[model samples]
Target chain A: MGKILQKPTGFYDKFVRKPGTYDQVTHYCPGCGHGRIHKLIAEAMQNLEIGDQTVFISPVGCSVFAYYYFDCGNIQSAHGRAPAVGTGVARSNPHAITISYQGDGDLGAIGTSEIIHAANRGERMTIIFVNNGIYGMTGGQMAPTTLPGQITSTTPYGRDAATTGLPMKMCEIISQLDAPVYVERTAVTDAKGIMKTKRAITKALKSQKEGYGFSFVEILSACPIGWKMSANDSIKRIEEEMIPYFPLKTFKDEIADRTPRPVVPVAPSQEDVLKALGHDQKEEILFKNDKKFIDDFTTQKVRIAGFGGQGVLMAGTTLGMLGMELGLDVTWLPSYGPEMRGGTANCHVVLSNKEVGSPVVESPNVLIAMNEPSLVEFEPSVTPGGLVIVNSSVVVGKCKRSDVTVLEIPMTEIADSCGLKAAANMASISAYLAFSKVIEKDQLVTLIKAKFKKKSLIEQNVAVIEAAYKYVSDHVRG
Target chain B: MTNDDKDIPRVEIIPEECKGCELCVTQCPKDCLYMSDKINQFGYNVACYTGESCTGCGICFYACPEPGTIKVFKK
Candidate 1:
């Protein structure tokens, strides 16, 4: 006698990925519809020969472990993001058939926008949406597809549409979109319904394999544990309660007439990507640093604080970029209030000879305080014998701590003399460089020229750097 | 169809994998499948097949949710 029916080759021979001793069985409860649906999909995959090229995107539900069963390229996406992730996979690998397997709570609730947009855009992917009435993995919470007046854990009383709105009909919504090639709503309550579901799944996958646009199959499934009923009763509930609200039918099927989507070109190369981002590969050597300045400062954790428009973040970025140009490991972390101009702002700049462990600078070795309030707030966190550069133009107070060296510079007046007030950040950078001797004075001017494209602005910034360097040498050192 | 016992169609249910949902037992038209009282390691009574009048219909194979639980052999 010949073997008529057996497990499909789409499933792993032994579910070694499944945890626990029962690798032979799924993690689903007894008589769960997920097992039936999974079997049908696997059978379809085996029959279609797309198992090797299929990318199964599992959602954040009980079926989150679908990767354990489906022996294909699997990606466990965040809740409701399967469609978005499926779009990426299908677009990136045009020959690969992507399956976004989602559940009611995932597709209908949190992932509504993702599903709608993915379908609307007509991404060449198949979305298998399992619409059980209640949330299964989360213990019978009210799902967007829950039947009206159906009692759930969240709805202690029966679900009242006046308050929580009616159950969402996703197939109806998807079929209304212009891009979908096939949209069907099937069930898995009986053998006939299961067969119909298999057919619908096969058709959906076929549409995707042929490069047809979006295809969706919403399968009305049963949740025995979530419904607080036996497997048999849950199947009956699907027939008697769920089918009336969600009628089983093909809402749209254009696969027979639709043409395959055009093949997407391969991704761009690294040099092309850099060029697209406005960077020339040849100019990369402009920032290359020789090791001559490495001994001046092996590492520096600098904190710059000021009002929003005072370019605190810009100053930190300048320092970080200088360190990066020197071939040192650097990180710039910005923290600012919600306002556009006047709110408090600060950024931490870390420059290290080795890989910087953490970007957060709790106790900075260098503090650039642009205003009096910033100096008062951040002076205490400076390490002993650290350097504090105060913007004496904006600050009227004196530094109380005698341990750390304080350099009070008129940054605003210096920037004004250089013909741009915003260039005060460049002045601060020049002062830091001059005092620390981390890099030569001309290096800061060259960096300014490389950073600013406008001739006038570059000239003014260079003037500010030179003037600030002169002030540091003549006033602070003298 | 042969009258020989070995030549007749039948189904074999893996006792360890059968979850005892009884969907197969209820859906079997030939009335050959039944739930046996022998509990397997996971502690549920598993479905069993009768030796006679087997038509080899694959309804029970599809009805049972657990994959590889039921394998049907046809005449």
Candidate 2:
């Protein structure tokens, strides 16, 4: 009888196949270093006996497919954001070991500040940085670590160092800081080099497992296809050109004399958690458990669209808060990415008796359009029997849809008469509720009094809401 | 499990898992592994044993990156 040498338990037994077939092969090009680096990491996880406690954070690059190989907890981060994600995972799951694996473009170009900040804070995690001199995944683009005079798809004329500057050495930059218990640079070209890389990977993981602070291992790898060279020539290039510039060495290793990280969170007891949440659970849950509110038929799916300064999101939030106060399930979703001021902004609000499955009011039952463009964009999406409130002061055009009810109110004009143009949101909401009979006017007045304390402001707001409602009711309803 | 006196170690390559990287062939000290002439189901040449030497050092196993691509057995 004889024993057969199989792979380590750190990887999935088989690869995910296509829709109809089972294929276990990786799509990586021949002589790529990512596969070799993955092997070393898997070996380290096996040798250190941390496969169960390991969590791998992979950012966008060749290593993003790491979850397919490693049988550990995996998280896919946005482009160049693995270090930030790994920091959160490490601090929250203190006992678990975190590994942040990234490539040259991810760490050197867009994610420079994220890695620097994470390392400066001394996050308890290990980073395996693969520097292949070019962006291999995104069609051989020029990365920040591309060597001077290296020819790539972007730098076809041979990289101009005088204009583009030199390649970044991450190990040297990280070692200059006071934190980071261990830092090393290794390669995987030959048998001896592979052995050294395995040891370096083991050391980095060990440092993280021992509760030491930040650790990083930068591996100078080869991308033969991206470099447009054969496997043999790529290995020689690592020795002749790459090794001299980026030497393999341990820049920092004080694991034997390092100090344990402080301030690991201790889980609070059940009574303490309950006290912090609420001492009187019965009273707090009464609002959510009301039968009459949940069974009401006055549910509204509202879409508020306008320019950013028009308080579209604030209007949605106020409506949602009122829904929650009246014992209804509410959801508010804003549709803007950092373009909130002076640009087009919109929000979707759902106040329903049943559970709200989605917060997207694609065909809104109620639309409050505060501008002409907003009305033009969202008017056709209203339900057949829905209500659309248009700001007639800014929206001069009439609604073309014949199926839905249209209530055109001069919201800005009423707000101007009420002494503040910012009260347009109050006017629109008040008019919609009064016409639809969704909520009692007395209840609204009581709630408004509880919210605003100043007498003059309350009087102006009440006058605007009432004025908009009376105008809409008299003209549109009659 | 004890090996017989006349037993020698050999390698088995699952053709589907091989992408013809030639990593194991370069790492093998005995010149035993080589790429086959025909391609597999994935349209890439797979590795094949030369049957010239068999030391069973398992260096080829370590060099092959894709897990479960090659298995070494003493028979």
Candidate 3:
């Protein structure tokens, strides 16, 4: 029999964990707006019923222990990269809801590029930008959002535009972007303010669940410790000071009917790959679901490369699992780097009939390069007469080597033709099935369909896969 | 465990002012303070704890950064 622990009624046992509940104690200074903002966000997540699928990215500062409070998948990111990391999660698994919680110092300063670019890309995500004027986590340093004439650790006397520049208006800047479908600036200084902030957070979360692109809610939080004021005084300061500059208002709300869009292909990023490789300090800040695949004795090696949003990694993961299901050893290797690419992106997969040692595919037996760069990077490594699949639209230049049989197919055109714009994943899966002949076509489709959580998305992807198979079978000959 | 317990200092948490930051819970040497489901005026859970279990250590009081949230009194 298991030991039982008892507690008082109305006490949330799930809220507490071993070594004590992470929420039992908090780090925010008294009167700090962070606590209120955190509560509001948590409540909104609970109300939305996305506690399981939701992934929260915690930024450096007073709210670093967000994982301890939010009862969901938690990724703790380095200062300012929460939005960037959240973007990766949102783009990779469109089905899961991703939330980034950040402070003025983390988001407005160090993460300016990541935040601005993410919003500009219109990546489907919900961001909670907490602006408390001063950097609470770092002991009251002057943040970019610090109000003019405000005294902080850095700005000893007062923030002067001539010397320190004026307070930055982030919400106003975010509103200027064409991609942000929903943007709001709210506060949590008082009871009424907390209510408004909660509404804004819930609305943003709803938009994200609906697959609306880039919903941002900026909270005019308070820094009671930094301000050297009482909790009540902090509330008074918000009413007297912060609200005048960052007014509570909704900037954008453009989605029609508010229903979430259908399954979208994953966007694999070099940054996401780097984090996956444990290169970043906050590597653990990624939302990795349960091991999506299980395997046996054989080994599998694969390479997938294509334009940025083609679901190269997903296809590899799907295939990696399929190989595992067949009792084969498997290795899935994705690319890691930074490049301003509008073309194709790629990933490598290795599934072997035996024990596999290395996951990196230096020379692969089967190669699928979706763009020119990937082929150029991987083609030299393919063995003689090895199967090489390239997107016909991108295989503009000659494949200098004739030793390898290169099958150029209009994969992009095929995906677009199937009413599934991002069906390249399905196309690649089909090609790999026919080329390797490793597993039956029906088996592979069943595996992929089971992986797709949504019933509606399965049909669209299945149609694309069938079309891809028909194309490969009719055109390619062994 | 006796009437002498009443002789110890007591710590009180202001539910209205508490944000459930849990800073006090982590810093409590005896591990006493915690987040309570007791709803506040804001309709949210507030961090709370009874003073009976307190050892007069004043750790929770010092750890609480929120003003007017944690108060200590000598019994």
lDDT of each: 0.89, 0.83, 0.72
Q: Residues A92-195, candidate 3, lDDT per residue (tens digit)?
A: 87787888888888888999999999989887788899888988777888999888988888888889889878888888898899888888998775445666
* Greater-TM-score candidate between 2 and 3: 2
Give lDDT for model 1.
Answer: 0.89
**Which residue pairs come into collision in candidate 2?**
none
Query: Isolated chain A: TM-score per model?
Result: 0.91, 0.67, 0.53
Candidate 3: what lDDT?
0.72
- Which parts of model 3 have CA positions greater than 4 angstroms off? A1-23, A257-262, A267-478, B1-75
Say which candidate scores most in lDDT. 1
Model 3 chain A poorest 10 in a row by lDDT: A1-10
User: Per-residue lDDT for A1-478 in model 1, tens only?
Assistant: 5667889988988887634767878888888899999999999999999999999999999999999899899999999999999989987999999999999999999999999999999998999999898889999999999888899999989899999999999999999999999999999978799899999999999888888989999999988889998888888999999999999999999988888988876688888899999885577455555776664556899999988999899888888877788788899999999998999999999998888999999999899999999999999999999999999999999989999999999999999998899878888878988998866787667677787656768888888898999999899897
RMSD of 3: 16.7
Q: Model 2 off-target regions past 4 Å?
A: A1-6, A12-28, A76-78, A266-320, A328-438, A448-478, B1-75
Predicted candidate 2 versus true structure: per-residue lDDT over A1-478, tens digit per residue: 4666667777777767356545455556777788778877887898799999999998899878788778899999998899999988987899889999999899989899999989888899999999988999988888988888888899989778898889899999998888888999998788778788889999889878888889999998888888888765787788788888898999998888878787477577777888897652543321335576467756699999888888788778877877777777899999864874888888999998878998888999999999988999999899999999998888989999998888888888888897989889887887788788876666566556655545668888778777877776787676
Cα misplacement distance, residue A322 of candidate 2 (Å): 3.8
Each prediction's DockQ against the real complex: 0.64, 0.34, 0.05
| Model 2 Cα lDDT, one tens digit per residue, B1-75 | 233443667777888778787878887888899888979877878888876476777777767767668878755
Weakest lDDT window of 10 consecutive positions for candidate 2 chain A: A280-289
Alpha-carbon DockQ of candidate 3 = 0.05
